[model samples]
Target chain A: MKFAFLILLTASMALAVDKIKLVSTTTDLAWAAQQVAGVHAEVRSLLNGTENPHFVDTVPEFIRLVGEAHIVCLVGMELEIGWMPKVLSRSGNAQVQPGGKGYCEVGSAVTPLEKPTGAIDRSMGDIHPAGNPHFWLSPKALAQASTAIRDALVRVDPQHLADYTKNQQALAKSLEDLHQKNMARLAPALAKLKGPAVIEYHKEFTYFFDAYGIKSFGSIEEKPGIPPSAGRIAEIAVAAQSAGVKLTLAGEYAPSKTLERFSELSGIKAERLATSIQPKGKNKGYIEFQNSLVETVLAALSLN
Target chain B: MLKNRSLLILFSLVCFSQAARPEAAGTGLQISVAGDIVGNFLGTADNRLLPREGEVVLYAPIDQTWDGALNLAAHNEDGEYKFEIHELTIGSSRLIPRSRFKVGQYFLGVGRLNQTHRHDWPFTSAPKVQTQFLYEEGVNDTGAEYSYLWPTPFYLDLTLGITNGWTFGHTHDEGKGPVLPTHYLRLVTYNDLFLDGGLQTGLNYLGRKDSSGNNTSLFGLDLTAKWREAQTLTFLFQSELWYRIYSPAAGDVENTIGFYAYPQYGFSPSWSLGVRVDGYSVLNSKDAGGNNVGSFDYGLVPTFSYKASEFSTIRASYGVKGRLSQGAVSNTEHFLELQAVFILGSHPAHDF
Candidate 1:
């Protein structure tokens, strides 16, 4: 009789568990979430700043994290396309998968860009048919991300509603200030340059580059993700030479020669832009990345 | 060449990685690698191509979610002639109608290395007969598999694969437009070690070939035992025997048996030593001839594996082999090999 009573007490305590501990795929997302939830939730991103956000995997640790979490927030629209299915299925975390109340897609309501128009298939290279899934890079998109995520948190912790609102407001205010500062810093270039241009692989920077008045004329690939051909390179070189464009964008995975050839032909400078920031040693937070992307693009554009 | 190869691999990784589905799987990406080096082929100049090497698949679960996954994987070595999607299976569990089905490109039913992942591999080499009969690595097909597991971890994995029986040449089917043999069935059970053999956990596999007319069969029995904590010893015995009545490549009815036995002791987590003896031959085949060969080998493989951190590992091994079966040895050869595998991102618990 005493053991039975003890078991009932333990089960009650388990049922009352409230804190929703989470592990994100990228450090930037984790840090941003931390800024909002702080002590209300324990958050960790699986990859350091160097890993690719689009391809992070949820192995045992990730599986365990999801199992322990009350709600899972993900960058949806096929961003984490390949691995998310495997991890969620193995994790047995119904709340975190699509269609579940606990499943939180940060950008579900945000309007997207670069969405695939034709029939989707692998022959077309890495295509995100849901449009540019890197919505976090744009401040407006971030605003939308906050709304969707806050709703998710509210569902997870109704009693802690006040706490969630406070953290979210603080994060939103900080973002507003940063957005204003970035716009001001970028105005000089936005006004002075006839047109700032770049060559990109994936259309990842559409929001950031567009917001800052930077123009990307063409991508390295003739089609999305396909390697640039000799003919395409020659054409881009001639066009860049004519437009006085001086900067070329390079993802960490791009071939060195492609960047070099662009420089040799069009006299443009290539800069390595980190598209994803994982949470780890080198990249402590997303703020560092924001300043870096702006400064790098500015410096590259200024050179031309 | 390696640098160039890495760039190409990275390119394909980025390109093919674009495959994404509805967000639901999980958060975080992971990659893992496991391979081997022949004992006699170590400590020599011709070590570029060792026992075998393969791609370490990359997956991001958190961002993509279930139903959605970003798989970027390719062989790191060379693309002279290789398949694009080798380890392309995805983990998925869903209710279709009233039944549950798992869909992915899995090597199920009856191939060594098909169901056994490298990280979970217990032996250094696969069965000799299968390796001898097949030239390509991972003779797997692109297929959708449905597996049903009773409350027991025991499982009945069924697969329906579509492709040319042989994975060779540019034309997979040479205008055959896929083939007649479209599906293979596999049944396996893990109840206990021989119903109750304190010695080990037992698993057996029975796979029906793609066609009903021709049958290719394989049976595997494995055991691993730790005799005493004092010595900390382990013994592994595996035999993969095949009886295939039809194979376009062999052009004959055949029966083949291959076996590998390895016994080792762990001095510590970072160090260990072991001896392996392996051999295979075509016991019965219509085309059996001088080409149908078998060999017996005795070798010593010393390994040093260190976990740099929770996310990474560095393992090095040195092995020496001697030909115990006179002419069975392909050639009196001495070789040296080195491998460096580092995985960063989300990963399963370290079983190395």
Candidate 2:
């Protein structure tokens, strides 16, 4: 009878554990959620740092994670349109569906850059219908996103609202400190550069560029999400060289061969940096991820 | 009794109106149009260039707990264009906890490929097993399905459904009412093999009893495994096997078995190559005169595809059908086909 009582007590305790299970579609969002939820929740990311957030494959593990989650943080703005909907619909977790108490779209908190004004279609090559979804690269945007996540957590677990609000404020302060430090250091170095500061592989670095007051000549791919032809590549290389572009930047997940060939042809240094926070290894947290990317860009421009 | 019935009707109308109110402001209809144009070669004279199929789908959020969709499909039939209402569904996953419910017409989820639209198929040709056991486009009927995800350590899902059985396969007739409707149950499970790799398997059973007491039952098993990297599918292996038993009211009972296996490799982000082998056999079948009428047919198809972007694809496939009798195999027919599929507007996301 004593042994059975112990077993029942353990089962009840397990059931009573009130840890919110939060699942985010991207690692950066997961990092922000972790900061807001802290010890009161378990945060997991569906996509690691290296995966392309635009075209993730809906794996079974993702479904299981979402199905068990009390809250799901979406980058939204169509960044995960190719896969997240499928996972959400199949997860059968109504609590995390759109408009539910636990459904949070972090991207909705920020006014994104490059919102297309006029008519848009596939001729633009896989353009996001809403706007650029790389707002996490900006500290101000990330702070706003953290607030959204905190609101979602409070809605789901009202008893811990104070904890969430406190954590969110702490995170916002740290993000602001980090942003000011980077801006102070980067402003002088960027002012010393000649002509455009960089050329990017895609528009993923738009927020980063905007945050640092950097000027980007253009993208390697003339049409977003489409591979550049040989002629197109040559044209961009020549134009970048003539325009005195200092560096070309891309996410590490991009094809290395393309970056190298462009660098060789244009005589501009190339740097591929991490765009998402890693689950492990270096650059594990959001702050570290931002710092590493900034350092890489500065080093590529010979200003580090 | 009449007063009670009238009150119940009024209450239902009020409930439906509340449930169907627009969920949010500025929400409008989402429409998607896709088409498949095919060119046939190395075949008979009748096999000329034609548009394979076109589909127009519209979706809207009815309210917080409900959504609706309509799919209109058109295809070329015997040098003429034929159109049909492919699917119309009202679905909700938030009405209940850990469960989803859908009512109206839809493509039956019997196998992996059955639920997927043909334009999204990896290959340009349909496998013999799919065409023989099911229809070329699988089966679509007015039905209601309820899916539940069991709470477990791994991913396990169960779906049960029933559909009107007036006519099976592709038919245009408004047939008489059936004595028994078609009912199906499917169980799905999966395992994570490695990073970015997943293997999913499903088992399905469907049965129907016609007005004439003729009974039909089917069993199916399907598997799909895919390994991918950023925007690149590295490898994929998919297969489906099925068994059918048909017991007529008077004639002899017949059994049919079929299967298809496809393995594909992606050499680059935009290009892929794959081959499919499929075969089906009928056992203990008889003609109208009561003579033995058992037969077997098999097909081999090899295909290649180039994806320009998410919006378009160009695929070429060669298929050859053969028959094995006694101790020799005889080739019966062959065709080389090419298809281009393009999508416009906001297409719905496909399930894994």
User: Model 2 in CAPRI terms: which quality?
Assistant: medium
Best by lDDT: 2
Q: TM-score for chain A of every candidate model?
A: 0.86, 0.94
Clashing pairs in 2: none
Q: What are the per-residue Cα lDDT tens digits for candidate 2 across A160-191?
A: 89999999999999999999999887888888
Residue range B1-352, candidate 2, lDDT tens digits? 6456546644644554344444532454666778999988885635666798988777777788898888877777777666678889999888877788899999887888788899998887678778866788888888899998888998898999999988777677876567789889899999878765889999999888887878889999999999887777889899999999988889778898999899999977899999998888887667778877666778888989999887789998888888875456776778889899999777777666
Instruction: Estimate candidate 2's alpha-carbon lDDT, on a 0 to 1 scale.
Output: 0.84
lDDT of 1 by residue, A129-167 (tens): 678787777766776677776777788767777887888
TM-score of each: 0.53, 0.92
Report, to 2 decimal places, the DockQ of model 1. Answer: 0.03
The lDDT values for all models are 0.54, 0.84
- The alpha-carbon RMSD over the true interface for every model, in angstroms, is 12.1, 1.2
